[model samples]
Target: MKVLIPSFYLILFLLISNCSTNETVIEDVTEIESVYFPTVDGTNWETKSINSLNWNESQLQPLLDYLEEKNTKGFIVLHDGKIVIENYFNNHDIESNWYWASAGKTLTTAISGIAQHENLININNKVSDYLGTGWTSASIEKEQLITCENLLSMTTGLDDSIGDSVLPENLQYVTDAGERWAYHNVYVKMQDVITQASNQSWSNYFNTKLRDRIGMTGAWIPFSDLSVYWSNTRSMARFGLLMSANGKWETSQIIPENFINEATSTSQDINRAYGYLWWLNGKNTYHLPQSQLEFNGELIPNAPSDMFAALGKNDQKTYIVPSKKLVIVRMGEAADNSNFALSTFDNDLWEKINLLID
Candidate 1:
């Protein structure tokens, strides 16, 4: 018995020592120095403080931080009214360009709104009026009804079967017109309508009226993974701020309230989603029927009803939640299945944010 006692004591002491070495106390974890939020700026976060907790000169937390640290292309956050979070990854400074993916549609929507503001075109006008005959083979009335609004709202009834890839143009727009809610890249390509109607290229018009006026210096023109119009991260954040402020730039009403409401709001074709070039949560607003959406589940798993987003493939997003008076931008790799890569960044970051606020 005496021999067994010493052996048991030795084993217990070793076990306790290992546990003490491995365990990280919560209080110690909570005291993490400044949290750095990610951004499109292409750098680690600069820290800022709200009340009790410190905000990563950008944004700091587990989930958000991890996202930015690994595989994060860029991220920007607008709280209340100012940009409080901007971070970039991989030696890719704020200068590194990113593919907006489908989020580019939101840019198209803004351009179309500008055209309407200038009186160059009306939303009710038929696409055929600009693209000419055979843009659609549907009935004359349906063709006429396929207006600029239809393109923005994703409501021309065009489906994925006859997607944007098939729409007609110069190696552009395809055959089918009205069917489902496929990508309507053709609608934005119709920026030609704006230029023809307003007499300027889309880039020139936006630069003169939007970018320059707002003191923005990044490229805002069109771009693709295969194109030359690469956009730096800062430019994208500027656009998010513009939307957060309801189309206003600095102190000017660059985007009219009516147009902002109409553009950011929902449409008639898609469900819980499918706003002309935009996406809505479809929880409450009476835009379209929830059952009309392509996805079976809710637009976002736990996104607030008032939350709307400009989403792109591979997890690029510009989330706008008016109730929270917040705009959160996230550009990253496909964040779906790769937990081992960067899941905790955002999770950890969000946990800290909760501590800062209520």
Candidate 2:
């Protein structure tokens, strides 16, 4: 009788242990899946205090000071879709509008993904399929070789030296498509492709498909041949939050998860640090804008290895780190020496950020 009683208790103990283990696994999954989303039409975004996160509050001021000295107009750090830090410097306020510069290319990438999902476009198709022929100075054969994916990956083989204009006269062929990676403005043609395929103006399509759906308030204003997106700082954070949630807002998959995975990963062999119009860190090697030189090591050495960013001229940035569940945004003028996309400022800024967040 005593031996049977001991065995029964042992089995009961094992069952409870297994049940506890299952509960722990469920809790971890729930934590990972949990995320906050701000209301689309109202200014009701949620925030998490630094104290709540147990972050180093002492390092906050120094980071803000460094940002101000570097000409930053607005800065925001989001953790799991909740605002952790929001600050504006250089006479810039929350209400002020700022241009995204080349950072807006990621927006085009997302919209292009949506177009593809809806069967309105295909990245594998030739750009001529949507825009017709003679879009560039390349021969029909060379031009046909340029797929919409080439534009997304910045491998159009177009002459970037001619400048940012997308006019055929300026988009002369440099080499075969996918032969090289150059950060040219030819990616803008994807916007035109979306326009052509959707039968709607670029802004109209962008507004209805992405901007409005995600509660982002912005407009693509024309600057010469370039169409730059401009929005307030919070709007930028909202977009980042959406991205941090793996292209979802609440229940709706605003951008396909599979597309987001591909867009954030290395897109081509030429530039290991580039995704679909997004700048990636933690790559073994990377190429920069307007230069063919491939630099060794990660794009931003101090940032998290999993970090990917949308970097723009004059230091506009939207850095998203998946492992850390963070989305950081910065907007304003040049940090130093008016550079395009990346600069020394990125490394220095991440140094200060590490102090506060780590």
Return the top candidate by lDDT. 2
- Deviation from native of the Cα of residue 251 in model 2, angstroms: 0.6
The TM-score of predicted model 1 comes to 0.69
| Residue 198 miss distance in model 2 (angstroms) | 0.6
Q: Per-residue lDDT of 1-358 in model 2, one digit per residue for the tens?
A: 1223356786686678787845422121122248989899957988899998888999999999999999999999998888899999988998899999989999999999999999999999999999999999999999999999999999999899987789999999999999999999999999999999999999999999999998888788989998899999988888888888888999999999999999999999989999999999999999998899989999999999999999989999999999888999999999998888999999999999999988
Candidate 2 wrong stretches, greater than 4 Å: 1-33
How do all models score by TM-score? 0.69, 0.92
- List per-prediction Cα lDDT, in the order shown: 0.59, 0.91
Predict model 1's lDDT versus the native. 0.59
